[model samples]
Target: MPTIKEIAEATGRGKSTVMRAVKELGLRESGHANPDGARGALIIDAEGASMLADFLTKNVEAKQAAGEGETESSNQPHIDVEAIVSVYRERIDDLKAQIDNLNAQLAIKDNQIKELTCALDNAQDAAKEAQTETRRAHDQVVLMASAGVWERLTGFKGLLGPGSDMDSQ
Candidate 1:
């Protein structure tokens, strides 16, 4: 991370210009947010610093090409290419870390979905078994109701079919 003043100095632009570019790019704050001229410095994230440097490079280059009061020593715009590249690298690393975190969360959610689906299938199987048992019980009731009182009172012998006489035994 770099400060706005550092970027402005490296890019040969005013601090106000760098601050405006920061606002325009819609950069979120990861550093101190004291804008009322507080003692703390407004540090910029790597992404914002890289973008700010790029923006300043183009704007300042255009102005310099117009020959705006430049001696032989001041002909070229002062830009720290190495620093800008470093900022870009930092931003890329940050993005990679975020992707890894999101992938882990996605994996967890996928596991949860698999567990829920298995539970539902098991519940469906249990309900089918209960239905089969209920049907068998209903069939037994129908058979008992159709038989005469004496036959039904015979219990197992009645279930063995009609015309069962056990009186001799």
Candidate 2:
């Protein structure tokens, strides 16, 4: 298999642009990943080679045929399968590098999301527990007041005066 950069160089186009074209052409990496985790290139048969050649020819001609302001030299030369494929191999390497980078980023984001979710759950649980504690404390204070502890502390006054026990009345 060819690297996309090599393919682009041979085709007289930018590397990224050629890479996109190859991807759009439905070319997938073989399952073999390099140490960097790029899909390795596959060995193409005659039919695949011919197809690539035809694609290059049509691509070059299409651009030239558009009758835009391109110079004569701007049009690509005859397509050489061997050279193009050579460049394509390098492009495949670059693509693998990109894939590795994206995978690493995704892993980091996944970890971060997991941590944040855990923290959120902990915070929610803590809030609920705190609310329960507050409710329990309020109940204890109401019980103490209903039992008349406040009046007993003051040792009694006239029944109808300030701080008197209405319950007794």
Best by lDDT: 1
lDDT of 2 by residue, 50-123 (tens): 34545766777787789568566634455565675654565667678889999999999999999999999999
lDDT of 1 by residue, 78-161 (tens): 777776777778889999999999999999999999999999999999999999999988897787678788775666464644
- Tell me how many residue pairs clash in candidate 2: 12
Give the runs in model 2 whose Cα sits over 4 Å from its true position.
1-56, 59-78, 149-151, 154-169
In model 2, state the lDDT of residue 169.
44
- Give the TM-scores of the predictions, in the order they appear: 0.68, 0.44
TM-score of 1: 0.68
| Model 2 lDDT at residue 24 | 55
Task: For residue 152, give model 1's deviation from the true position in Å.
Answer: 3.4
Q: How many residue pairs clash in each candidate?
A: 0, 12
Clashing pairs in 1: none
